[model samples]
Target: MRQLIFFGWNFIFNADVSPLRHIPDTKRRHLVLQALGLMWAVSFGIALGSYTVLAISVLGHAVLIAAAAVTVATYTAAASKPHLFMSGLGRSRDGEHD
Candidate 1:
């Protein structure tokens, strides 16, 4: 039990030894940090009865979800119809510069 507590403390306080380092993508790391910030915001809002903060955090979460959905849709569309999106960009269908 004591070892587990110490591990948790180290994980929270020691950035150099944290699990975030294992994530190779910078965007994913940023997303994780943003999520942690939102969790803290929600916790603070609930603890202090700040409905405004809670609303803002909820809005932020919604924005993130929307952005992710748009990104997925764009990728899917691009994959399905690469020519439609990539045309007039000085590149050919074979990815060669014109």
Candidate 2:
């Protein structure tokens, strides 16, 4: 809990707060990967014209279904990964850091 507040203050006050200073490099990489996955999910959801339509309609529809599945899976996985959560965000994981 304290760490979250500290992270935000550091962002405002300290220029030396290296982005990777708080988390391990490995975890930082995972965080970037997860963030990119989330962005991709948004793009896919936006570009795919009709959401209610099932993927069985056309051959290319399978791509939409696959993308949706990936997005859901990434969301699920992110829920378990604490580094993926922004510290200053209202949704702090409490003891759920992983």
Candidate 3:
């Protein structure tokens, strides 16, 4: 949660600073979220294996899959165009249209 908050803050504040910043922050956040999702999948998969119960572990795995899917889609989308996510960090050129 804390890591997510930090990522959000960076996204909100630093996104417009540069294309490089946009690429790294987007990629890093995706990676972090992916790791967390993997942790959930593995932990619950193991729990389900040992107990033969299909409830808690199933819920956990579903959550994991959902998180991973969302992040992957988001990152892929962001990888295109990019200026959408890099909305604020640049100095405006006079009379230049974006």
Candidate 4:
């Protein structure tokens, strides 16, 4: 248990696998945006399930679902192609630093 806790803490604070280091610059932004979209989708599903099971506040559940949807949409769009609004947000493809 102690070792597991230490490993978790280290992983959280000092991650060894940096996406920038592991993934090529061309695909790094796409990968990050895709991951963000996936996370939002997961959150949406979890919130829906929780509301169904716990019968919690409908307003809160709706808000969570809406937020997740919007976030996922934005991330998906950003991942699909480069846009003026999201300029300077992702890694450069012209051998430029982010």
Candidate 5:
């Protein structure tokens, strides 16, 4: 069971970042980068649709744009400056807690 868990984790979280070691902060940066890209895409789609097929009201479109902007900005900052997401618990980004 433990091995299964470890394998799953490595497959999902450590697959790309393996060569860099399991730095949690670095992993977080990767995740945030992905999220930033996703949100940016979503925002683009919504903005485009708002101009054509989507029937969303002006206020709804504005709110969606605002949320997307916030998400992109937050994740971009986190991914760009990894230290901001550090655990700072005197331990590596591994599961061990010191």
Candidate 6:
């Protein structure tokens, strides 16, 4: 059980061995990560009873908005300076390793 838990954790959190590694385009890979983050954040908020059929509370809305803002900011940063996010990946614009 412990091994299974550890594997799950790594599979979700470990970038070095992530499926993203196969995506040679750095921008595309980071974009995918950003999308995943946004989805996770929104899903987490929903799981915590943030959203309801009737209405959403101010705090819940604020949390979701903040998540969206962060996603946009990170996307902008990744687009302008992808090198900051490409530490161990070493992939260049032309899909060549540096």
Candidate 6, residues 1-98, lDDT tens digits: the string is 99999988777656666788788887888889899999999898887764563355766788999999999999999999998887766557766665
Q: What TM-score, computed on C-alpha atoms, does each candidate reach?
A: 0.39, 0.26, 0.33, 0.32, 0.30, 0.40
Better of 5 and 6 by lDDT: 6
Off by over 4 Å in 3: 1-52, 88-98
Q: Per-residue lDDT of 48-70 in model 2, one digit per residue for the tens?
A: 84553544466577788899999
lDDT, candidate 3, 1-98, per-residue tens? 99988777665455454233545578775566567669989998998787876666788999999999999988987898676766655765785545
Candidate 1 lDDT over 42-81, as tens digits, reads 9987878767778899999999999999999999988898
User: Better model by lDDT, 1 or 2?
Assistant: 1
Return the candidate ranking by TM-score, descending.
Answer: 6, 1, 3, 4, 5, 2
Give the runs in model 5 whose Cα sits over 4 Å from its true position.
Answer: 1-24, 54-98
lDDT of 6 at 23: 83
Cα lDDT, model 3, residue 34 = 68
Candidate 5 global TM-score? 0.30
Worst 10 residues of 6 by lDDT: 50-59
Q: Considering every candidate listed, which one attains the maximal TM-score?
A: 6
- Mark the regions of model 2 whose C-alpha exceeds 4 Å error after superposition: 1-24, 50-98
Clash totals in order = 0, 0, 1, 0, 0, 0
Name the 10 consecutive residues with the lowest summed lDDT in model 4.
12-21
Specify the poorest-scoring 10-residue window by lDDT in model 5: 15-24
Q: Give the TM-score of candidate 6.
A: 0.40
The residue pairs that clash in candidate 6, if any, are: none
Q: Is candidate 4 or candidate 6 better by lDDT?
A: 6
Candidate 4 lDDT tens digits, 1-98: 99988877555433243333444554665567578669989999998998787765776799899999999988887788657455686678788864
Q: How accurate is candidate 5 locally (lDDT)?
A: 0.72
